[model samples]
Target chain A: MTAALPDTKVLSPGNPPLSPARIVVLGQDTPFRLDSGVELGGFRIAYQTYGTLNADRTNAVLVCHALTGDHYVAEKHPVTGKPGWWNLMVGPGKPIDTDRYFVICSNVIGSCMGSEGPKELNLVTGKPWALDFPVITIADMVRAQRLLVEYLGVDQLFCVIGGSMGGMQVLQWAVSYPDKVYCCLPIATAARHSAQNIAFHEVGRQAIMADPEWCGGDYLNKGTKPTKGLSVARMAAHITYLSEAALHRKFGRNLQDRKAVTFGFDADFQVESYLRHQGISFVERFDANSYLYITRAMDYFDLAADHGGVLANAFQVTGPDGKRTGTPVRFCLVSFSSDWLFPTSESRAVVHALNSVAANVSFVEITTDKGHDAFLLDEPEFYQVVRGFVDGNAERRGLAARVG
Target chain B: MAGHETNGHIRPDLERIVEWVQPGARVLDVGCGDGELLHALVRRKQVDGRGLELSMDGVRCSVGHGLPVIQGDADTDLKDYPSDGFDYVILSQTLQATRRPREVLEHLVRIGRYAIISLPNFGYWRVRMELLLRGRMPVTDRLGHQWYETPNIHFCTIRDFITLCDDAGISIERSVILGAGERPLPHPAASARANWLGEQGLFLLRRN
Candidate 1:
C-alpha cells in the first residue's frame, strides 16, 4: 500500500545517529552492465544504516526496499518529510532490532530517490536518463547492494530481509551470494511474478504513458511532471496492495464528508478521496519512468526460468564437476493470508524448493485482513515470528546481546 | 504435550521421542507444538529437523527456538511431501485430532522410513471406568478436556492402533505403553491387556 505518510522526518526517540551516506559502487574499473547488455561506466548507490556494526562486522542486517521505497529505513524521508517506510519494523526494539544488529537500506538502482535512476542526469548527455536509462533487473539491484555490503567491510550479512519487491531481492541475494548471507527473510513475495502481477503493473505503466504531460518519457527534460497519470497509476496500483475486506471495512460506500453524493465524480466516496490522495502524494516523491523500470524488473523475475526451469536449482549451487551443493544460509518465508498480491502459494513454492534441496527453511501464512501491507503494519504474530527467528539465529550465531 | 520448554529446558516425553531418532537423520515433526520433540532431537542427535504445526503460535515459537517449522495442517499438507522424504516423521499425540487418521497414518509411513507416533489410549481402564460410571468422556490428565472442548476426534486404543498399522501394511518396529507420569506400563504386545492398562502408547513403525 502507499504508506500513509506523516509529513515529518523527525526520527523516533533514541535512534542511533546516521550520516547521509552515498557511494559509487559501479565505476570505470567495473562498468555496471545491464542484463539487456548495456553498460554504464559509473553508477552510485545511496544508503542509510542504523545501529553499529560490531568489531567482527557479522551483525550487519541488509534491509532491501520495496517497489517505491528508498533508503530511509528508520528515520524520516528527505523528500516527503515522512517516517521511513520500515520505521515500524526496523526500530531499536522492533523485529529487526537495530540496537543489536547493524541495519542497512538503500534505494534500488532504478528508483527515483538519491540513488542513480531515470531521474538522474546522464553523465554523457547531461540530461535525465528517463526511458533511455536501460532497463535493470532484481539481480542487478542485488549486485549493487553486494558492493555496498562489501564497501562497509561486512563479509557476511547476519540477515537479509525485505517484503514485496524487496522480497524478490532477498531471494536473489540468497541465490546469488549463498556464502555472504547467513539467513534470509523474504516475506509477501514470489519467486516469479505471476501473470496477474504483470498485468496489474502493466495497467499502472499504461496510466503513466497515457498522460499527455508525460512528454513521451522526456517529462523531466521538458520541465513537466506527469502528475495526473502517475497519480492515477498509484491509485490503481494501491488497490492491489489491500484486500477487498480492508477497503470495505475502511470506507465501504461511505461518502467523503457530505450529506449525499454530489453525483459528478468529484470523489464523493471516501475510498475515492483516499486513493486520490495516494496518487497525488506519490507523484511528489516518485518518478514515472523509474516506476516503469522497477515494475518491469519485477515482471522479468522468474527464479525457476533462470535455473533451467527447476525452482529448486535456484537455491543449489553447481560446482566445477557439475555436482550440486546446498547453501548454508537459513531462510524464513512469511506471507499474509490476505495478500493476494503475493499469495501464500508463492511462498509455499519457495518453501517446497528449499525442502527439495533439504535446505533449512521456515515458513508461515499469517492470517490478517490487512492484505499485502500486513508486513508493514503492526502485526504482533508477524513480529513474534521474525523476532523469534532473528533472536534464535542470533543465539546460534553467538551475536552480541541487544543494547537495551 | 508441552514443548521442549524454556531455554535449555527439555520435556521427558519429548526426550522419549528423541530416543527413537538417529543422529544426523532428516526428520519431519508433523504437529511440532513449540517444537519440543524436534528441538530435542536436533540438540541430542544434531538431526536436520523440520516441523509442521497448525497453530501460528506454535509455528512462531518453534522458529523462535531456532527450529525450521512451517504452519500447515497434518491432514492436507502431508501429501505434499515426496515419498520417504525423511528418515523419521513424527506425529505425537496428534493422530486423533486429524480428520482422517487412517489416510494420515498411510502418509506417515510413506513419507518416512520410520514413523514415530504417540497417542492417548481410549481403552485404558480409567477412561473405560470413567465412561462406564459417569457416562461421560474421560477427563484424565493425559486427555485433560471435556468431550466438547477436546480436539481429539479419532481416539484409538493400543490394540486399535496396531490393527490399523497392520491393515495399512506397516510393521511395528518398536513399541512402548506408558501409564501415568511417563512410566512405561508393563505390557508385552498390543493385546487387550496393554489396550486396557496403558494411558498412552508410543510406537515406531516402518513401511512393509
Candidate 2:
C-alpha cells in the first residue's frame, strides 16, 4: 500500500469512519486494469453485505449501484441518515428478500462514499486524483465488481441485479462473464447510452466544470468545494429522472410558502423549490469530480460495439455441438411507460436481440407515470415481477427455500 | 373423441390443437390470454414457450405465473418479428378481435413453420337461430356480449375461414369442429353439415 495523504480531510468534509463499510485494498500485484489502459498501484472498494452467505456460498447475489448510488442498499446511509436507496425493494420478506438470499452491494470504483474515486488519494502523488483519474467504462465497473465477488470467495452469483447505470453493469456482467451469473435483472437500462442521454450528461459535466470554484479539478487541493456547480448539475439531471406528468402531479404551479408569486426569481414555485432542495441536498454527500468520471463511464457504454455490430453477437454462447445454443444466463428486463430517458422501446430492442440469439429472456414494460425513477419507487407490479422471476429462477437452480 | 382433460374438465378443441404441436418445439402464443395454453404446452409438451398479450392485466397475470410474455398488439407488432422465428405460432380465440385477421394470419405463417388458430363459429345453429328468430345479434356463451359492447368485430364461420385461407394460398394441414358444449364433432369438419352444427373451429395451417 502507498502512503496515506497527511491531510485527507481537505479533499472531502464530513468524512465518515469506515467501520460499517467493509474495505478491500487491492495491491500493485493484483492491480485493477481499467478500460482506459491506466491502472492504479493500489485502491480500495467500500462495500456492504446483507444476509449470511450459505454454507456452499451458492446463495450470493451482487447488487450494483447506479451512478449516484453507494453501498448502502438496505440500511440507512451513514452520511445522509436516510433509509437505504433500495430498502423498499430489498429487505426481510421483500422482493429481494434477505431472509432467503445473501445480498452484497458495492460502491463502484468511479464513485465517492469511501470508494476509490477522483476524491481518493492517488498514493503516488499523495493528492486526490481528481481530473488526473483515467476515464473508466461500464465494463471497467463490472470488472471491478467481479474482483470484489471473487474476493468474497463466491465462485458464482445466484443473481446480479440493478437499474439504470447499475443495470448497465448487470449487462456487462452477463456479456463479460456468462458462466458466472445464473440470473440477471436489468431494469430501465439499455445496451448503449442514447444520444439524448449522452447530451444530458454533457450538460451536467459542463455545469461542474464551469463552476469558478472547480479551479481546474484542483478544488480539493485549493480547499474549495464546487457546491454551486454540482448542485446545478444534480438539479438538471433530476428533472430527467422524472416525467412531466409526475412533476405536474407532484408540484404543478402551486406557490411555495406564499399566496402569490414573488416574481423575484427566488424559489417562488413549488417545483423550483423542490429542484433547489434536490440540488442542495445532493451536493452534501456527493463529490463533483466523481460525477464527471461516472457519467463519462455511462456515455462510453455500448456492449454491441465490443462484439461486432450485431447486438445478438453479444449473447452468442456455443454449445457442445458447436452450434449457437444461446447464453445460459436467464435475463429479465423491465422498462417504465413514462420513462423518456430509457423508454419501453429500448427494452424491446434488447428483447429482440436476445430472441435473435434464442437466449432465455423475459421482458415487462410497467405502466407508470413515474418515469425512469419508477424502479426506485414502491411499484407493486414491479416488485411482483421481480419476486416471480427471482423465485422461479431460484427453484430452477435447485436452491432450497430457507425456512423461517 | 377424447376430451382434453385440464383440471378434470374436457376442452376438446384446445386438446385437438395441442395434439398438433410437436414436443420440444419453439412456440410463440400470440394473444395468449393468461397463458393457459402456453403453460400447459410448457408443462405437458416440454416445449420452449413465449407469449404476446394485448392487455396489460393479462401480461401481468402471465408474468406472475413465471411465463415470458410481452404486452403487444398482434396487428402491428407481428410484422416486426423475424421470419421463421419459431416452430409453431398460435392465436387462440383472438382472431375476431384483431383489426386485420388476414394480415395477422400471414405473419403467423411467415414467422412460424406451422400456425394453430381457434375461433368461435358465427354460423353455428344456435347463433343463426338467435339472429333469425330474435332479429338481433346472438349472445351465447361463446359470443357473450351485445352487438354494441362486443369485441368480436370480424366474427367468421368455419366456411368463411376456409375460403379466406384458400384465397390467401394457405393450406390447412388439419381441421376440427367442436359442438356447442366444446365436444368434438363426429363428422369431418369440412362437411357442410358440421359447419352448421359446430360451435367452434380449430385449424392447423401452413404456407403453400
Tell me, by lDDT, which candidate is best: 1
Error of 1 at B185 (Å): 1.9
Kindly provide the TM-score obtained by chain B of candidate 1 when compared with the true chain B. Answer: 0.94
In model 2, the number of clashes is 0
- lDDT of all the models against the reference? 0.86, 0.85
lDDT by residue for model 2 over A285-312, one digit each (tens)?
A: 9999999999999999998899897788
Error (Å) of candidate 2 at residue A278 is: 1.2
Worst 10 residues of 2 chain A by lDDT: A4-13
| lDDT digits (tens) for residues B1-208 of candidate 1 | 2436544556555667887788999999999987777877877898988999999888877886678898889998887677777899999999999999999999999889999998888999999999999998799888898889889988988888888999999999998888767688777656778887888888999989
Model 2 per-residue lDDT at A179: 91
TM-score of chain B taken alone, every candidate: 0.94, 0.94
Displacement of the residue B202 alpha carbon in candidate 1, Å? 1.0
lDDT of model 2 at position A357: 66
